[model samples]
Target: YVVEELDVQNSIYEVPLELARQELDVKTLDLLRLDRRTLDLADYLAWLDGVLHPTRECTIAVVGKYIKHQDAYKSIYEALNHAGIANNAKIRFLKVEAEELEKGDPARILKEADGILVPGGFGGRGVPGKVRAVEYARTRKIPFLGICLGMQCAVIEFARNVLGWQDANSTEFDPDTAHAVIDLMAGQRGVTEKGGTMRLGSYPCRFRPGSRSAELYGVSETGERHRHRYEFNPAFRARLAEAGLAATGTSPDDRLVEVVELEADHPYFIGCQFHPEFKSRPRKAHPLFNGLVAAALQHRQGR
Candidate 1:
C-alpha cells in the first residue's frame, strides 16, 4: 500500500488468502498417504520421527573440502541416516573442513569422531588434510570409509608414508609430479571438455572371494554410481598391493581398480571408486554405510 501511494513501479502481486488456503488443502490431501493405502500422514510422521530421533547416537566426521555447502554431499549424508536408522542409532555428522586438517593434527579436531568418512570431491585444495585424516584412521584403527577422491587420498597416503614414496601425488593435483599414483582414466584421456565427460552413472565391480568388502556387500558382483575422470594408476598397482593395501574389487575385466581395503586387523577401513550413497535408501541402507555405522557403534563402545 505504501509503495502504491509513492507511485513506485513493481512487478509483484499478493496472493489471495482463500486461494493459498485452497492450494494448501489440496497439497495436504495429496501428501496424506504414499499410495492408495490406509496409513495416514500422522502415523507415518510419528514412525519417521521415532526412526530419526533415536536414543543412541554415533558421531561420524565427514572430512571434505566443501564443508560450507553440504548439498555437494547430500546423498552421502542421507545414506548415513539410512544406515543409522537400520542400526537403531542417530547419526551425528561432523563436517570437518579439509583446510583445517592441513594445519595441524586432526586428533584435536576429530578427537570425538567414532568414524571418519572422506567422501567424493575434485581438486587438491584440501588433499593434504584428507591424507592426514586417512593416516589417523589407519594408525588409530578407527572405522573409516573413503569414497572417490577419498580412495585416491588413501592410496597416496599409503604410498608416501607406508611405501616411502616421498614425491607421490595424483596427476590431477600435480600433473608433473614424480609419481602420478592417481591419473586420468584411459577412456577419459585426451578429453579437453570438462562438462559431462566424467565416468558417470552405474558400473559393475567384482569383489575378491574372501575380502572384507565381499563380506560386507554379501555379493561378488554389484554396481554403483561414479562421477570421476581420474583413476588409480595401473602402473603402481603392484607396489600398492605389496604394501598391504588389498585390491578387493575391480572392473569386469580386472583392469580397473574399483575397491581397496586394509587387512582384517584394521577393523573397517574400506574405500570405493564408486558412490554407494547414491543407491542407499531409507529402508535399505547401502552395505558400505551400514558397515561403517556398525563399526562406529563398536568404536564408541570401546572408547
Candidate 2:
C-alpha cells in the first residue's frame, strides 16, 4: 500500500478565525481550486466515494478515553448512525487513545477524519488530548461537534489558543486555570465519591435569539436529558463571549449552560453541555446529531 505523505503543518494553523474564513486555503473548508485551463472556476466536489455505502458517508474520529465501554457511549454512537442512515450516509466511528494524541502528533488520525467529536469523561487522565483535538478543529475550521466534556475542551481550546487565556482549564481537571472556565456546583451534596457528585438528568435551556440550536429545535427554549456533574462556571460566560465564544443556550434560571455555537460564521461548529443522544431514536434522530452529520456531508463534498 502506498502511504500518503502527511501534512504535519496541518496539525494547527495559526490563522485568525476570520482570516481562515477569508482564505480558502484551510484543509477543512472546500478544497476547490480555480480551473485556469477553462478560465471558469469549477466547484470541485469530493464525493464520499469509497468511504460511503448505500448511505454515503465520511469517517469521523471520536477521540475519547472511555472506548472500553461502548455502552457508556452506546446511545451516542447509535444516534450518529441513525442520522447517517436518515441522510443516506453512514457515520463512521473511530475510538482513539487520548494519551497518544497528547504525547505526540495526532494530526494524521485527526486529518483522516471529516469531523471530530470529543465526548464526556471524568478525571484528567486524557483531557489534554481532547483539548488538543478541539484546537485542531477550531483552527482548521473543521466540522466539530463537542458534547459535555467535549464542550468544555472546545472552550478551553478557544481560551488558550484564540483568547490568550494562558491557564484555561476545567475545574473538573484542574482547579487552577488563571480563569476557571469550569467548576463544580455549589448547591450539591451527598457525595460518595468524586465520581458521582455531578448534576445529572434533565434540564432546561434558554436560547439566544437567532442561534443555530434555537432554529434547529424550532424553539428558543427547550429541554434535554443530561448525565453529567461538572457545569460551566457562571462567572466566565461574559468573558468567553467577549472573546467571540458564546454560551448561547443556558438553563431556565440561567444558572447552567446548555449549548454553545460559534459567535458567527463557519458551517456547523457546535458544542453542547448535554448529550442529546440518550433521547435519539432510530426513526427520529436528535436534531443535534442530524446537524453534525449534515456538516460532515458538506465537508465531504468539498464545501
Candidate 3:
C-alpha cells in the first residue's frame, strides 16, 4: 500500500496505507467537475443564488497539499463557486503548508479565512498542524471543515485535549499508542492493499434525529462517496461525546464512524469521512457544503 502525507499543525504524523508493492504505483487525489453531472439549469441557478454575493464577498481558504492541482478538486471548488454565485463571494484555494502552523500563530496565515477547509490526505507528517488548525477554528468560532484525514484530526484534537485521551491517535500512524483513536477494519477487504482496500464510491449515512445534516439533505438518511481505510474507533467514541463532540452521522452497519459535528452551541463546524465534494453538482450543491459557505457569509455579515 502507498501513503500520501499532507500536513496541518498542532500535531504531526503519517498514514501507512497498504498499497501494492509496485514501485510505479502512485495515488493522486482526483478533481471532478460538477457541470458534467449537473442536469438542471433551474436547480443550478437556484443553487447559485444561495451562494453568490459580489458587492459583499467572503474569503474561504481551502488548505491542503494538492491546491496546485485545481482540476483534481474541480467539483469541490466549483460547488464553492456555484454557492458563491448568489452571495458573490469569491472562493479562493490556498496552498497552505501545514508545517507552518505547527508552532506559529495560525491567525497569521489563516486570519483572513472566513471559512477553513482541511481536505483529505494520508500519513502523520501533517496531522499536528491540522489539529492546531481545528483548535484555532474552534477557539475563534470560524467555520471549519475536515474531510477524511481532516476528520481524523478533529477527533484527535478533541480526544487529546478535551477528552484527555493523551495517547489518542490513529494506529495507522502510531501503532504503539495505548488509546488508538482510529484503526483499520479487521474484516476490511477490497482495501487489503492500499489502492483497492479503502471503501470508495457512494454510501449512505443514517443521521441522528434533529441534525443539521438531516435538515440540509431534507431527510434523516443520506448517501455520499468515500475514500479512506482507517475509521473512527468506537471504543473512544464515548469519550469524544463526553468531550462535547457529536457523532452526527454513521454508516449502514454502524461499524464505521462517517460524520461528526460539533455541539449546537458552536458555529458551523462539521467533518466527514466521505468527500461530499465528490458528489456535489453546480445546480444541486450538497447541503453540508452549502451550509458551510452560508455560515462563512454570515460571519462576514455579522449575522
Candidate 4:
C-alpha cells in the first residue's frame, strides 16, 4: 500500500527535503536539482546571512490619511521593501495622519524619520497636513519623496511658501480657486464620468539631460504607470522653476509635467506624477524607490 502526503506547508513532494549528504548523488531520491548552479550552497548561505541580518535599520514616515488601511498603499509599501532589500537595510514605516500635521508642527511628529514619503491619494481631506509635512522635509533637509497627489500637495506648498501664491490649491479640491497650481488635465476637462476616466496605465516621461530624476533613473526617457486626472498647471511652471522647483521631467510632447525636483541646495526632494511603486519587484527595485532608500540611509548616517 502507498500513502501520499502533499506536505503543503513544507512544499515537499513525494519525498522529504533535506540538506544534501555532502555531495548530491544523481541516483539519490532526495535530489532537488539537476544543475550545478543549484548545488552552489556556499554563496547562497553568505547572501542569506547578509540580507537576513542587516547592519542598520531606518524609519520612513508615510504621511497620508489612509493609515488605518495599509492595503491602500500596498504597492508603495512593497516597493519600499524592495528598495530596502537592494540597500541591504531594514525599513520600518511610521504611519502619520495628515490631519495632525495641519494642527501642529510636522517636524515634531516627523522628528524620528530617517526619510519622509508622501503617497498618492484623492480629495482634500488631509491636504493641509500633507503640505505641512512637505514643508518639514524641505526645511529640515530630510530625504523626501512625493507621489501623485503628494506631488500636487508639494506644488501647493511651494506655490504658497516660495512663489507667494497664498491661496494656491488644486482644482480638484476647489475648482473656483484663484491659484490652481494643480488643475484638471486638458483631456479631462468637463468630463462628468469619474469611473476609470483618469489617465491610467503606462506613459513615457522625458527627463532633462542632467536632472536629478534622470540621474536617479539613469536614463533620459522612461515609462511609468499613472492613475490621475489632475496635473501641474503649465501657467505656474515658469514661476515655480524660476523659484528653484524645476520640472525635471515631462510628458512625451512636453504638454504635462511628470516630475519636479528641488535643486542641489536640497539634500533630496523629488516628486513624481507616476506611481513608481507599481513597477517594483522583489528582485528588481524601482529607481525612484532605490534613490529614496539610499538617500534615507545617507541621512541616517549623517545624523
The lDDT per prediction is 0.85, 0.75, 0.74, 0.85
lDDT of 3 by residue, 188-231 (tens): 63345687668888888998788767776788788888888889
Ranking by lDDT: 1, 4, 2, 3
lDDT (tens digit, per residue) of candidate 4 on 1-303:
122222233222212224343333433534664444334334434444445677777989999989888588888889998888888889999889999888877768998999999999998999999999998998888999999999998899999998898999998888888999999867777678985458899999999999988998898999999998898999889989999899999998998999999884777899999999989986688998888989999999999
Error of 2 at 248 (Å): 1.2
- Find the 10 residues in a row with the least total lDDT in model 2: 38-47
Residues 88-173, candidate 2: write the lDDT tens digits: 78777877777778977777767677777888877788888988888887777778889998998888888888778878887767
Top-lDDT candidate index = 1
| lDDT of each residue in 68-152, candidate 1, tens digit only | 9949789989999999988889999889999899997788999999999999898889999999999999999999999999999
User: Number of clashing pairs, model 3?
Assistant: 43
TM-score of each: 0.83, 0.78, 0.78, 0.86
Higher-lDDT candidate of 2 and 3? 2
Residue 127, model 2: Cα distance from true site in angstroms: 0.2
> How many collisions between residues are there in candidate 2?
4
lDDT score, candidate 4: 0.85
Model 2, position 237, has a per-residue lDDT of 86
RMSD of each: 10.7, 16.8, 15.2, 6.5
Clashing pairs in 1: none
